[model samples]
Target chain A: SQQGEEDPQALSIQEGENATMNCSYKTSINNLQWYRQNSGRGLVHLILIRSNEREKHSGRLRVTLDTSKKSSSLLITASRAADTASYFCAVGTSYGKLTFGQGTILTVHP
Target chain B: GAGVSQSPSNKVTEKGKDVELRCDPISGHTALYWYRQSLGQGLEFLIYFQGNSAPDKSGLPSDRFSAERTGGSVSTLTIQRTQQEDSAVYLCASSQGFGGAEKLFFGSGTQLSVL
Candidate 1:
């Protein structure tokens, strides 16, 4: 079963705009990580935010986690055409398994 | 290899046929994971191996699916009597340690098509 659920199943924006994706999970987690998949192939690790920490950033990607609400969000600033891909949020539990959510497809038009 | 490597970037097999997918994780990495992603669907956890410890096979969907990691390095996932529902991209990933808090490096994955 999937642990996380991402909102806004699809998003379309113009270049230089910002895109935001949200995810909600069912249970407590040790950490949460975001990944990007291009062409429905391999997924690349984007950023990871521990349960103890509220936010993390990598390049233009920003991730925020809220344990109380059991949700997280990913924000891509100044989106580019290269940013078009499927974004997924995975929840890492105590058992060492990372369960992914139904990803949000973001399309950045140039 | 600098990153995880999977064999036969694409495979097409007939129903009831058996297929083996191989994954070679990065050198020195101890954790390996298998996941299945259907078209337009979230990834489904298949299995996980960490060092010499017993593998976690709770995520496997059926007895037809089995996997093994040899020498704590290369891993293979075998599916017997393939079904159309089994057609999906099988992804292999490896991490330096256990995955609860570590990032995983992924391979391009094998696109399996069962007819």
Candidate 2:
């Protein structure tokens, strides 16, 4: 089953602009992961932030997790047209299964 | 070799027909998972397998859906008597282990169309 919800279901931005997506969950998680999916393709793991870590960075991607608030956010800096796609946040709990959010659709206009 | 792979990129079958979708996970990965994503819907977990132990089949939707991982490697998801509502993308994901720190590597998925 799906674990959470993502706000601003769709966002449009121009190249070089920053894009931000938010996710909120109900249960405590060990970690949260961000993934990107291009049209008609599979998802690619972008970055992962553990519960102990409030924030993390990978290349142009920045992810922030707030355990107390039970929410997380993904920020893409200097967005490119190639970065246009759907972004999803998967929360990992003590259980082995990973529950995902509805995802945010990001469109970067060139 | 670096990512998960799936077969038949697309599959179209008539109602009441049975279809098999295959997934070849990353080499040496100990955990594999199956998920189904209907159009405009969040992915639904179908099943998961870890090593040689019993699979976690709690997420399967119905008796029509079943999966098996052979030799702890390649896996297959079979849907019997498929219905129009079953049309969706079947995704396969695998990880190094069943741990909170493990990140899943996903396959492109097979787009199934049941008519």
Winner by DockQ: 1
Residue-level lDDT tens digits of model 2 in B33-90: 8988888767777888888889989889899999999999999999999999999999
Q: Put down candidate 1 lDDT per residue, B1-115, tens digits, no spaces.
A: 9889999899999999999999999999888999999999988889999899899998899999999999999999999999999999999999887866788899999999999
True contacts kept of 2: 0.54
Check candidate 2 and list the clashing pairs.
none
Tell me how candidate 1 scores on lDDT: 0.93
- Give residue B13's lDDT in candidate 1 (0 to 100): 100
Which candidate gets the maximum lDDT versus the true structure?
Answer: 1
lDDT of 1 by residue, A34-74 (tens): 99999999999999899999999889989999999999999
Runs of candidate 2 exceeding 4 Å displacement? none
Least lDDT summed over 10 consecutive residues: which range in candidate 1 chain A? Answer: A1-10
Recovery fraction of native interface contacts for candidate 1: 0.82
TM-score of each: 0.98, 0.95
Clashes of 1: 0
